[model samples]
Target: MRFMTTSDKPENATGGESAADDTAEVTGIAAQDWDRASADPQYRAAVVDLLGALAYGELAAFERLAEDAKLAPTLVDKAELAKMAAAEFHHFERLAGRLTEIGEEPTRAMEPFVDALDGFHKQTAPSDWLEGLVKAYVGDSIASDFYREVAAHLDSDTRGLVLAVLDDTGHAGFAVEKVRAAIDEDPRVGGRLALWARRLMGEALSQSQRVVADRDALSTMLVGGVADGFDLAEVGRMFSRITEAHTKRMAALGLAA
Candidate 1:
């Protein structure tokens, strides 16, 4: 994974940062003359395709999570998830703007990878509220780790955008708690959720492979003895972390991981 500037700090997120400055931070990425990069054409296409997919992924995630938030059992839980979902909408707008600043039409740029991401979601759509939380907790976190990896390849503004969109621990924790609560109500959910989580991972990998197939600039094949962007090792490590979290969540609900 390449290292780049990403504003993961809470202060740099939507709350403290001026909305107008978002344009400046994004413009910094545009300053880099992408046309000058002499990387493999496939590699460049790969990177763009990945970013485009993530850009649209956030958009779809926001819509789905917001709708799912209505499943919250209590008014407070409903409000909390709904607010988090709105935060995602704001993130979607910023990412879309960054894509435009980088010289790509947000919608058009996102088109190539749409099938993969959307298809992944469709195949692994959660069966129940607990499964939905598991999907949110696992899927969004993995995507964040991936985003951080890509941020390394971008300039400061792009890096900041990537970091800004990362899921906050607080929100993820809330979802985790919700999942545990549901599971505690019935231990049988343990096996079901585990399978659901695995399905999510499988679907994610399937879409990811499709993305890496044509584009080499992002995580191109072993190029010059090194993969360009994302690699299995890094993804595996991320999955290890996710697995740990999943285990902890399952234990909290009185089940084995």
Candidate 2:
């Protein structure tokens, strides 16, 4: 997947007039700009927390992908992962820059999320190249789905940035192709990957809940204290959607969900 580099500039979050209008309509923000929406300190805090979590996620993804590359069986695979790692780092830069633009220090913003995310990586460390690929695809997608659910309720600018940064980093298709090929070569691999994916699913969901629970602003935003936040019913439905997507991705990878 193509991605921005250091020379590339960030998108103008303010320029997506039609898209922003649609999001604003859905979220009941009525086209409120970030300036107006951020007037509320709680909402601003939520945005900061959201950006912080996402920035750190991208940075971690970059690191993980680079390390996973060392396990590649071929030079082509290594190069491919390197490219993807660069893309993830590019995404991190965008998020970090956005945090700075919004008057928050990037490192400080990401600090609160470091322990949770790092602990997740430690607990769910993959044993090999295939497992690493599975982790990147399954684990990252779950996080993206959760963020997308929350993004639906955010103001236009923040929503746009969140969605943009969550773009696929060539991992989904790459993982599916590599994993299915492996399973085809030895069908027993399917069972192993299936189990690995299930473990990733549980851990990812747990971390997601933990992160939100630890952040009052984020939790409040998700549970309806902020702009058009989800009610309890919708929160349940959101997880259902995320799980459904996970099942589909696992099928694509030739693994049971």
Candidate 3:
């Protein structure tokens, strides 16, 4: 993924910075560029909130996938899940660094999202390996789509960062293949997995609404508030696009959306 610019150590760099931070500073464009681009307070706040939410979401996904890896029936399956978990962690580290470079405390930026994300995970905990796979595929796809949609409204640098981190590293195909093969072997399992996917979607939508309500700036930007702001009709159309994508993904998994 392409990053913006590389910069020297922030004169205030603490020895405690992680390797991800070091790598980001070396590869990323100078922080001053981001600061200048986000001159508008509202735009800056929305961008910060968006990055924070994404950062926290990736971190939570990493933890959840790692836990689900234990449910894999075979060593091969476990290894695949572990790879996905690692990918999520890599995305999280990139996002965290971007947050810091933009002058936001990564932890503080992510803190507000903890409850919303954690609650969604708790509510949609998988019952078995199949359910977990479906959750990973459907849930992550929805998130990636949503971020991609929002990225269109962002400045070039921020949009590049968002799109880059959202790259799924081909894990969606892995999940879809595993789930579809399992269903083919046991026809009845498809019904159960289909129902689980629906439940995941519902829980995700609920949590997303909660996040929007809690983050005014981010919500505004999402609904077209960044420049001219999106009208209700356009927002409806935007959601329709998201729903259409979800339907196609579900069909790929041989499940109903």
Could you tell which candidate, 2 or 3, scores higher by TM-score? 2
- Candidate 1 off by > 4 Å: 1-47, 167-169, 221-257
The alpha-carbon deviation from the true structure for residue 9 of candidate 3, after best TM-score superposition, in angstroms, is: 40
Worst 10 residues of 1 by lDDT: 11-20
Residue 224 alpha-carbon offset, candidate 2, angstroms: 2.8
lDDT of 1 by residue, 81-174 (tens): 7787788778778778877776778888788777877887788777666777778877787687666655544544444667777748356788
lDDT per residue (tens digit) for residues 1-257 in model 3:
11221113233221221112434332322232455537657667888999899999999999999999999999998998899899999999999999988789999999989999999999998988889989988888889988887766566688789999988677798988888898799989888888888888889889988988888787776765333343455467667888899888888888877
Candidate 1 has what TM-score? 0.71
Error of 1 at 44 (Å): 6.1
lDDT of candidate 1 vs native?
Answer: 0.61
Reference-based TM-score of each model: 0.71, 0.87, 0.84
For each candidate, how many residue pairs have backbone atoms clashing (under 3 Å)? 10, 0, 6
TM-score, ranked from best to worst: 2, 3, 1
Candidate 3, clashing residue pairs?
A: 5-28, 5-29, 6-28, 6-29, 224-229, 224-230
Which lDDT values do the candidates have, in the order given?
Answer: 0.61, 0.79, 0.77
> Could you give candidate 2's per-residue lDDT for residues 117-162 as a string of tens digits?
9988998989999999999998788888888777766766887988
Clashing pairs in 1: 3-152, 4-152, 42-216, 43-216, 43-217, 44-217, 46-215, 47-218, 218-229, 219-229
